[model samples]
Target: MKIELRDISISYGKRAVMQSISLTAMPGDVTAIVGPNGCGKTSVLRAIAGLAGYSGQLLFDGRALDRPPKKSNRSLVSYVAQDSAGRSSLTVLEVVLLGRLATLGLRVTEVDKHVVCEVLAELGILHLAQRFLVELSGGQRQLVFIAQALARNPAALLLDEPTSALDIYHQLHVLEVVRRTTQKRGLATVIVLHDLNAAIRYADQVAVLREGHMLACGKPEEIVRPDVVGPVFRVEMVSLPGAGNYPTLVATGPVHGSQGAASPT
Candidate 1:
């Protein structure tokens, strides 16, 4: 499935959060949205998931999304928020099983349970299936949330800071799972990430956002550069050779003025 956003704009009350944004996500690829805080990354995902009201086109499989027909849209897309507070009272398995509600239509069958269990296992959260969501750690809760998103078996998966609150090991683990799932199942995945390293390591394409505007979008190698990253992040970056041809970013403190003082842009 191909997901396209054409001139999309979103607002909260009278404040415009995102303005005239356009992007695309192709099947069997992982696209990472990266930016500083409060740059409308989450708003973009919410618009795509039909959770936020917006003006402009959200095209799924070449058709514009309709408001009242959100169920049909939901069937084709899964959204995993940064926080799991949306349905925390439910047990892990129950929360994961909710993904099947759209297709199952209030009927829960053994097959649904089987699918939930298999997804939990696949995400390495099977042991937490019977546990209350409140009892799990942050990383474990994130795993459960991702398991639920995967249970829906949607063509496109949208994630907001999917690795936030996770430890380094779990962060890598979750991103690896996302990468493998997209490749093996041919699913289109769009994730918002704050960590540039993780985005470069996991995503096939990177989209950099600045103040609700997309500054750059391309392969990791093309987009991950000091010239492009410095202005967006408002910090000077020194590129150093890494394990492969890709380079690592080292903060050279902050940009300085001619007077040898920190210059805040």
Candidate 2:
């Protein structure tokens, strides 16, 4: 799937969130959206997921979508949101089964079970199949939701801060799995990441947004330069010495004369 957003603008009541925001995520590639807090990163994902109404166009492989995707749609784009965890008694297996509900008959079929199991195993969470959602930690629930999304077999995967609750090991593991899956399944993967280094490591392309506007879009290395990072986040991004061929950036401190907090978008 190839997702294209053209001049999208989103607002809530009387408040505008994003304006003329455009992005493209291609199949077999990962596009990571990065910026400071409240920069409309999540809004962009919501618009592309058709969960939020926007002023402009959202296209999937040249086909326009003007409405939220129905649960019955088999080829629906999968979205793993930031606040995905819920207080529910549903076991991990049961929740994942919902992904195949559109194609499921009255009873759960072997194929559906197989697909659920496959995704759980891939996420290394097969042991969590019988665990209730409320019993798991935030990070564990995050992983479960990711498995559920994968079980849907979507052409496009939208992940909003997927690694926010995870530890260093799981963060690296999940992203590696996402990259491998994106390439192997030829799926378009768009992820919102706060960790600049992680975005650079996992994403083939990077899109930087600030105050509801897109500032840059290109290879991760090019987009994360000091010039771009410093102005957007108001940070002094410094490249360390002997950081190998690929530079590693660290925000040493706030830009000398920048403001306190970035205004909400």
Candidate 3:
């Protein structure tokens, strides 16, 4: 399913956070949303997940959806939030199985169990299935949650800071797995990332948000350069040639002088 957000504006009472913004995510592609703190990145994910109210349209496969996802529609949209706090006695397998918790009835079907195991294996976390969520490391737990989302066999996968608390190794692992899964499953994936490099490496498209407004949206290589990224984050990005055709961005320092204070137009 393709996700299209047309002229979306979000607000609480009189306080408007987002205004007349539109972005699209095609199936078999990963779209990354990057912005500074309090820029409504999470809000955009929520709107698409049908958890938040908005003024504009959120369409799936060219049909405007006016309600939250229903099981009967055969449309599954999985959202993995940042504060996953899996402080429970549930084992990794059990927790991942709960991805279909909303759809399961009296008895668990073999197909559901099969999908759960398949996703775990794909994430390289099948060995940790017997381990308790509370007993695992931060990176392990992150993978477990990702497995949980994929287990739902979703058409669109929404993730919020999936690599926020991980080390460099785990960060790369999670992003790589996410990118691989998106392509393999032909899923429309929307991720909110704080790391620009991760966006450049994994995202097929990038949406740059600032204070609830999208400054730009397009290919990561074109939109993530120093000229475009500098004013949005107010940082000086020193670029270097990296692996493949991607440029490795290094933040030298904060933007200073009169131009430094200027915001992206």
Which predicted model would earn the best TM-score?
3
- Candidate 1 clash figure, as a count: 0
lDDT of 2: 0.84
Candidate 1 structure quality by residue, lDDT tens digits, 125-159? 89888899988877777878888888988899999
Can you list the residue pairs that collide in candidate 2?
A: none
Scored by CA lDDT, what does every candidate get?
A: 0.84, 0.84, 0.88
Best by lDDT: 3
State which candidate, 1 or 3, has the greater lDDT.
3
Which candidate, 1 or 3, would have the higher TM-score against the true structure? 3
After superposing candidate 1, which stretches have Cα over 4 Å from the reference?
Answer: 85-89, 104-107, 256-265
lDDT of 3 at 186: 96
Locate the minimum summed-lDDT window of 10 residues in model 1. Answer: 256-265
Q: Which residue runs does candidate 2 get wrong by more than 4 Å? A: 66-74, 135-138, 241-245, 256-265
Q: Estimate each model's TM-score.
A: 0.90, 0.90, 0.93
Residue-level lDDT of model 3, residues 1-265, one tens digit each, is 9999999999877988898899999999999999899989999998888888899888899997646556644346888999984587999989998888876889888988788888999999999988899999888899899898888788999999999999999999989999999999999999999999999999999999988898889998888888888778888878899989889898989876534223233
In the order shown, what is each candidate's alpha-carbon RMSD?
Answer: 3.8, 3.6, 2.2
